[model samples]
Target: MKRFLVAGALASTLLLAGCASGTGGLTTGSVDSISAVEPGMDSGMVTAEGLKTNADGSVASDASGSVSTDVSRSVIKTASVSVAVDHPLEVAPELATIAANAGGYVQDSSNSPASEYQSESIYVTLRIPADKFDAATAEVLALGTFVSSSQSESDVTLQVTDVDARIASLTTSVDRLTALMANATNTADLLAAESALAQRQAELDSLVSQRDYLSNQVDLATLSVSVIATTDAAPTSQSFWDGLSQGWSALVNAGSVFVVALGFLLPWLAILAVIAFAALVIIWLSIRASRRRHESSTPEE
Candidate 1:
């Protein structure tokens, strides 16, 4: 009787120990199954038996920990680009629309006045979806000639990781408070638990919102494009009445030139006039001398 009692006591102790050790929640009755689970896994309402591995090395039930991800994200990213092109107003909006289709927006836009002989110019700033930045930039380049372009990138990986860690801590605190609420024996305790839970939840919400905002900033790129177009001079034609008036004015100018040419020969005309005067004087003196000599010769006869 004593031996049987001892044996029964040992059996009960072993069963109780196994339950306390949580062996029921393991695969093949092994406690190492807990080690297989990863942190941040949402394992709610799943049975131990359901977690057993199959012959194919796959879990019999869905386990988020079964897969691991290496894709990490940055909290903030800042990039700036400057480009020069032709026809900014026309090309800028088109580029802005393309950015929008790719999940971007136009922040600002401006255009310079067209010169009397040249085309207009445009300047613009655009926000683009992170994934479509490269493609959209290539399309903008196709709009006109490239004068200058520069790109820069910044990473906030550490900040993002820190925020995620805070979120996790807040979540754990909330979980603990939730578990405490199930066993609250007094009104004061229950209120305290609820208040802590609310605070943690609010903190978590803020962290999530900030992280999302920062992630978006990093994911998208901004491009500032300036456009300049070459302008050609246009020719103008004159009317028939204008042409006739110009020709008549030219004829009048020719007559004035002929009058100037004749005035330049006035010295030669003056010399000829002086010689004619001298010859007339000589003839008059000879006529007087002949008359006087004839009178004197007739008297002598």
Candidate 2:
């Protein structure tokens, strides 16, 4: 989705333009250096082989091989958290307020009602300014007892750079095409130039839009919150009504189990009952027939 389907003629044009201007590349025009840790140094100090460390503790190399010591990085951050709260239904509003206070907004949210076996829960997605990500997360999670949380940071620096390069190349290409259209001589060349310019312009606009979207994502961090309801007090409600309610729930659950077990055994029980009745009927009929035969075969007494 990052790269568009550049047309054949457009590709050729870009290639020739790149060759002409020497500007078609995806690199950030900087050297990336690797650093390794050497024992016997400071516990947290990192040393690069044959590289000079400046006063600010930045690494540098020879003039012929200057390394990027302060490369700007683009990162997208996201997090998910689940916490047990006293009031799950109110979590969304409180979370929204927190996000707003932190220069953020709630994108989506939902509340679930309490169930027989499960508690009420709230699910919300938030977009907070990246600078406030940690603070907002802390404030939100502090709303309740922290159950669990996880975070992820995606390194989109390379992607951002690539998109920027493509956008720059497209812009240049569009400018060149615009100039060509202005000086086009024949009708055929004009029409072709117009069509190509339109295509390039559209492509350039799309890349610019994508770049903007990517930058927005890097600037704002996303947070997903799952608020699980829990009573402030355990061993709750010594009241008679509460006891009765709990007992009733248990009885209903036990009754449900009994009903299921009965349903499962009903068919087998019916079959066995029918077989027993048939056996009894057959024995009784045989006894009656034998008695009649005996009477018939017996002499008058």
lDDT of candidates 1 onward, in order: 0.59, 0.71
In model 2, the runs with Cα more than 4 Å from the true position are 1-71, 231-256, 259-301
Q: Write the per-residue lDDT of candidate 2 for residues 148-231, one digit (tens) a residue.
A: 899999877656765665576557767767766666656766676677667666756766787888899999999999888766
Q: Give the residue spans of candidate 1 off by over 4 A.
A: 1-79, 83-86, 100-123, 228-301
Backbone clash pairs in model 1 (N, Cα, C under 3 Å; residues 3+ apart or in different chains), count: 3
Clashes of each: 3, 0
Per-model TM-score versus the true fold: 0.45, 0.61
- Identify the candidate with maximal lDDT: 2
Give candidate 2's whole-model lDDT: 0.71
Per-residue lDDT tens digits for candidate 1, residues 1-301, read 6445434443332332222113332112311222222245432221222233443555444355553333354523334444444445567668677778888888788887777545677777777877778788877777765555777765665556546554654565556567666756667666766765665566567778877877777777777776766332121566898789879989998898898887987888898899999999999999999999998888553
